[model samples]
Target: MEERPGRFLGVDPGAVRVGLALSDDDARVALPFDTVKREKNDKAAARQVRSVLEAAEVPCAALAGVVVGLPLRLDGSEGEAARRVRRFAEALELTLGVPLHFVDERLSTVAVERTLRTLNVPRAEQRRVVDQAAAALLLQAFLDARGQETWPEADSDEAVAEGPSPGDEPAPAGPRGRERRAGARPRRKRR
Candidate 1:
């Protein structure tokens, strides 16, 4: 369990289960990490996620920030599901004391399902892993665009360089502004 620095956590928020992924130290590759079972409590779910982040396996890695999948509709409009995800993201951000960035996850699940079919993954197993796979896809999309000039420039206030150390006070309130990225639209904060 080697600790890698500068890793980013990616999340796919769901009502029943939350999928997670982690980026490499360089932020070039994304890998499926784990799935957290949600007990209908946002705070509890966020705690579970924080546990994963604080795992011994990645002890030295500083959490750069968090990337959440915003499940927008095909027409580019946010529906109830997207709103739910945003709320979850906000809660998780507060819990982890990290900045949050959102990526449009229009067909991340569909793409993961297609890949699972191509790989001949068993249906039962696919059900268990699809969310993790979708999370990885969403994270990869963000990593891929991060180095491109066309990517939307995130506000300086919204970009986190490092997370709080253990036993330290939780980070201050995050930036209210949205992160602008290429091909991905920013999620508006609900009133």
Candidate 2:
């Protein structure tokens, strides 16, 4: 292999929009790039990704691999959406001649939504920004789990520079919190 920066491309594939994210020039951090609309003809979406790769000056031979978001059910089961994503990834691998990987995207959308909400983004405007944000979340999650590079922990700089996103509600703190509060319900008086 040419062994360039080894930058990886992260994809959050959707029926209507395919979000694209890229690792840094040094392949150190993955950041959201763009969201390409998937019309009746998916060729349009592929073209958009090609443009992004070209604009970024991504070395065709240097791509370490492409990471795709795998949507899993609450019990970690793959559904139709997940299958579609996998199919898309496979097509990319064959077409682009690059290795492909998958990362669990169980709650990536939720995470992105929480981020937007924390930043005080407006609800009506969220549709325009959610895909890219989801892409960033998906890529960052993959990088973190792989332990492949030293991605910056600070999300502010990357996200802010890209642009503010409109998000959704934050997820509950954690399972422990949910459990702790599970029994704290209103007490009923004896009738």
Candidate 3:
């Protein structure tokens, strides 16, 4: 654990489950955190997510912001799903008091599924971890994009005006090279 300057929470909001990921303090790596089982009430789901965030034990002040996966259609249009994600993001912002940033997550779940299959994860087991895996993928994209100078400041007008730039090319469909297992043990911190 080298001293990370900051961290960001990543969200993959779904109708039944909300996936969560946390970036390294340096914002270089994204790790699966947990999944929030949603109730019929959106507010209740938001509360569940907030509780998880609090229970992670990291200081809220160390978080840079929240990055939410926006599930846009292939044509880059916001469908009903995208609208729901936006609503969820708004509610989460209200609950957590953190700025929200959206990242295009067109095939995040598919990518996660592919990685699981490659790792020989059983179909039944995949269902349990898919959401969190997708969240890690989504957050990894945001973290990688940030390295490339794509992410704007959380409070900047350009962030509002331009939205999250996915850059000119789409992210790879699946995790590159090695597969990251769900709930993998955290790496030991170096002295």
The lDDT leader among the candidates is 3
For residues 83-147, write the lDDT of model 1, one tens digit per residue: 88888888888888777889998888888999999999999989899888889999988888876
Candidate 1 has an lDDT of 0.81
Candidate 2 residue-wise lDDT, 42-116, digit = tens: 455555676677777775567888888899998999988787777677667765677887888888888888888
Poorest 10 consecutive residues by lDDT, candidate 2? 174-183
TM-score of every model?
0.72, 0.68, 0.73
Which runs of model 2 end up more than 4 angstroms from their true locations? Answer: 1-5, 41-44, 148-191
C-alpha lDDT of candidate 3 relative to the true structure: 0.82
Is candidate 2 or 3 superior in lDDT?
A: 3
In candidate 3, list every pair of residues with a backbone clash. Answer: 1-189
TM-score pick, better of 2 and 3: 3
Q: Each candidate: how many clashes? A: 1, 1, 1
